[model samples]
Target: MTDQTIIWLVLGAISGSFINGLTGTGTALFALGFYLVALPPLQAVAIVALMSVLAGLQGLWVVRAAIRSNLPRLARFLLPALIGVPLGVGLLASIDAGTLRLAIATLLIVHGVYFGFRTTLPRFRARTPIIDGVIGFIGGLFGGAASVSGAIPSLWLSLRPWPKAKVRAVLQPFNVVVLAMTVGLLFFQGAYNERAIHALLITIPIGFVSAQAGIFVFRRIGDTTFRRLLIGLSLLMGIGIALQELF
Candidate 1:
């Protein structure tokens, strides 16, 4: 790799890992742009997926107790998502991926702007298993079709009144499992060639350190602050996705 490529890779790793550590989602939103500057689309995506899974493992540990306590609730979202992935992959050949991404980007922008301006964020305290499953399935579909599984779920989860750990428990594992499947799919497609492996080796260590830094911040933040962070992330992610597509 050129010096510039290595620089981009390092930046991507730091940004992606830190966000994943802090929020349990959004590695791609922050990292993919940097990766694209350094590598081709497939390789950039593969690296980000692997980075997300690896960084997310640490996040999973951060919320392990909450995850254990909410197994049933997690299942309500996860099972349908599992079912949705292959279906989405099947549709990928038929759908316009860029258009789909643009549409999702618009939804995220609108949702973020509306919720972000409110002084008291809307809280859905009641359990809604059906809605959760539907969102999860759609998120998986987006993951398979466009590699943005975390977008919808993160938007939904940020509205809940759960503690930070409890929210992270759901979002972190969900992204890890879904993105792990994505990595396997990419592996079979030969996206991880020697060049990709070399790039990964260069970036993973930096990503680990950056992730730790984010986790330190995560540990110190209040629950309400974390929720606001997610809202802000949603707006930023939306703008990022839109800019990525338009340019």
Candidate 2:
């Protein structure tokens, strides 16, 4: 790889690590930014998915308390996530990546904007297997297409009457499966050539180091505060991405 490309990969890994740690979206900011700066679409998706798995496994270490405390809830989310992940990956293969990116950007932008206001959407309250399957299916599609699929499921799980620990645990299994499904698809697509694989090699290790820093930092802040920060950042990034088509 050229020096410039290597730089992008390193930067991508760092930026991706920060986003997942801070926002829990796999690669909304970094992966989207790389593509905005003109990386090939297929490559962009692959890098985000690969680094996501690495960073996620890293974060998994820190979140074990959250994971272990909510065994039943984790079970509730896992089966559906696995079922949805493959369907989501299949959609990734069929749709136009650019179009999917634009659509996801638009969805995030709209949600961010609405969140900025006092307006709130109703939360999902269903506990049936069908509901989980449906949410996971749609979430998987969006996750594979745009790396931001967990938001809806997160919200849906939140509406349940469970303790917050169990509610948050709902995301772990889903994200793990999403990352795995994406990696599998990218492998079949031959997205792991020398350069992309090299990028993975360099960034994933650093990503783990950074994740520890993220945990310490997150401890100093409250979720309410972090939620506002994410919304604001996403608003600006959304406008920037949407306008990118103009340039």
Candidate 3:
């Protein structure tokens, strides 16, 4: 990789790692913004998937105790997600790269605005297994396309009545399994070759340090402030990329 490319990927990797460490999710949202600037859309997607598997493993370790208790809840989310992922991957493989990037950039802009502005979201009183499974399927589709499976679940869980710890516990394992599958799918699609391996090797150690630092800051900072800043940056970058591609 060129020095400039390496620098951009490292920045994105560290930032995404930190976000994942803090929220147990949101890594793809932040990382894709930077990766899209430095790499091709599908390459960025592949890199985020690979790193997310590592990050998700770390997250699950931190919440290992809570995973057992959330099994039923997680199963409800996981099954439909698995069913949907291959379908989404099929779509991704068939779509034009420019169209895929446009789709990804649009999601980033919309989701960033939504996450940044919503101080509190209402809990759904009518949540059922069917609804949960559907959300998982949608999340899986997003994951297959962009390594962003956590977005739907994170938003849905945030509004649930579950405690914050339970939410994090569920999110960690949920994202882990989905992201692992995404990596495998992308690999079969030939996204994981020498370049992908090289990128991962260069970024892993730095990502580890950044993730730890994010966990520390998560405990110290005001969540609202940190979220607004990060998501705001994502929103701006998404816009820039979309405009560049269009023009």
Candidate 4:
């Protein structure tokens, strides 16, 4: 690979993995743009998916207690999401992925801007299994179609009156599992050629180190700060998506 391509790959790895470490989601939102600058779309997506899963595994450990305590709640989102993925994959042939991504970006921007400035953040105190399932399903659909499984759920979970770990327990593993499946699909489709493997070998270690740094920051932040960070990330992610697509 060229030096320029290597630089972008390293940058993407550090940025994406760090975000995943801190927030348990948003690897693609932070990293994909850099990857696209250096590689083709399929290769970029493939690399991001694998990196997301690898980085997310560390996040899973950080939130292990929350995940174990809330298996039923997590399952409520995950099971439906699993079913939704195949349907989403099917829709790809018919749907314009860029249009779908743009629509999601708009929704994220609206949600972020509306809640971002509020002195009091919104919270869903009561149990809402049905809504969680729907969001998970939609997240899965986006994951399958656009490699953006975390967008919907991350937005939804940020509104919950739960601790940061609890919120991440849902978001982290959901993206990891969904994107693991996505990686498998891509593998079968021959997205992981020799070059892609070489890229992964070079960047994965850098991603791991960056993720550790992020987790360090994540552990130090208060819950309120973490929530605010999520809101800001959503807004930034929306802007990133819009620019990446429009440009």
Candidate 5:
């Protein structure tokens, strides 16, 4: 890879690791954003899925406990999500997806804004796994396309009284499974190849190392600070997506 691509991929990897570790949606947005600019649209889609599968797989180690605590709820969410993912993937294959991506990005920004602005969102203290499955399916679908999966669920989990450690742990593995499914579909469409593979190999490690730092840092930072950062990024990412399509 060229130095520039490597740098971008590395940044994307770290973003994935941290977000997946701390929140849940994995790094689809950052990876998609990076790949969108770096590769052909079709290839970018595959590449994003590829990284998600890998990173998600890697993240399982972090969030297995979260899954153990809420298996039934997760099953509900996953069943619907699994159904929705293929539908979403089909949408990706058939549509002129720049618009889809634009839409997804728009939602991500909105999701992030809501996450930031809400001072007292309900705690997921004990949520239905089906809720998560549905969210995950939509998130996987949109996440596969727009890389914003982590935003919604993360926002949800962060608000819940779930221990920060458990939240992080459960999210890591959850993303990995969904990402695996998403990428498999993408690959069937001829999106998988040496380039995407090489990219994943090189960058996932970057994400892993950076995620360790992100985990530590996340533990240290207060919720107030995290919300502020999330809001700012949401605004910026939204505007950037708007400009990418409009301009």
Candidate 6:
């Protein structure tokens, strides 16, 4: 890779690690800012999928005990999401790269705008497994298509009355598994190559180090302010991505 490309990967890894550490998710949306500039949309999505696995695994490790204790709740979301992943991967392979990027940009923009002003929406009681499964399916579909699978679950849990820790416990592992499945499918389909593997090698260590720094920062701040900042940043990035791709 050229020096410029390496620089973008490093920056993306740092940004993604920070976002993942602070919020336990949204790494793909935040880091895509740099990846999309350096690689084609499809390769960017693939690389993000690999990094996302690392993020989810790290988050799960932080709450490993909680996950072990919540098996029933975990099953409520995990099973159907796995079932839905192949379908989503199928969709990914069928679309042209440009159109897929546009769709991803649109999803990011819509998610950002909605969550950024979430208080405007009426609150409702958190529902049961069926809804969770549906969200899981949607999350899987999005994950397969763009590597931002956690975005749907993250936003869904935010609307619920569940504790923040509980939300992270569920969403993080779910993202890891779903994206893991995506990566496997992509590998079988021959989406990975020497270039993607090389890029991953450069970014993974940086991701781990930056994420630890982010977790330290997260512990120091209040959740309310962090939520606002996360959503606001997502919105701005989404707008920038959409504009860059569409025009």
Local distance difference test, each candidate: 0.91, 0.62, 0.72, 0.90, 0.61, 0.73
> Please, what are the lDDT tens digits per residue for candidate 3 over residues 1-247?
7999889889989988987877777677668777877777777788887777787777677667778888898888888888777777678767664575577668667866786677764455675888888888877876675445776676566556565556667777888888888888778878867777787787788778877776676556553444444456456545654765686
Worst 10 residues of 2 by lDDT: 158-167
Off by over 4 Å in 5: 93-108, 114-134, 140-148, 218-244
Clashing pairs in 2: none
Q: Is candidate 2 or candidate 5 better by TM-score?
A: 2
Superposed by TM-score, candidate 6 places the C-alpha of residue 85 at a distance from the truth, in angstroms, of 1.0
- In the range 1-247, model 4's lDDT, one tens digit per residue, is 8999999999999999999999988899889989989888888999999999999999899989999998999998999899888888999999999999899899999989998989998887998989989998998988898777988888888888788888888888998899999999999999999888989998899999999999999999998889888888888888888888898
TM-score of each: 0.98, 0.76, 0.78, 0.98, 0.73, 0.82
Give the range of the ten consecutive residues with the poorest summed lDDT in model 6.
118-127
Q: Compared with the true structure, what per-residue lDDT tens digits does model 2 show for residues 105-145?
A: 67657866776564443344565876776777767766666
* Model 1: worst 10 consecutive residues (lDDT sum): 79-88
Model 4 poorest ten-residue lDDT run: 145-154
Q: What is the C-alpha RMSD of each candidate to the true structure, in Å?
A: 0.8, 3.8, 3.9, 0.9, 3.8, 3.2
The local lDDT score (0 to 100) that residue 135 gets in candidate 4 is 93
Task: Report how far off residue 123 is in candidate 6 (Å).
Answer: 5.5
lDDT of 4 at 190: 92
Instruction: Report the number of the highest-lDDT candidate.
Output: 1
lDDT at 191 for candidate 5? 81
**What ranges in model 3 sit over 4 Å off?**
37-40, 93-121, 125-127, 219-247
| Cα lDDT of model 1 by residue, 1-247, tens digit | 7999999999999999999999988999999999999888899999999999999999888889999999988887788888877778889999998899999999889989999999998788998999999999998999999888999998999899889998888889999999999999999999999889999999899999988888999999999999988988888888998898899
lDDT of 5 by residue, 180-242 (tens): 776676778778677777777777677667666655676676655554554455555565666
- Give the top-scoring candidate (TM-score): 1
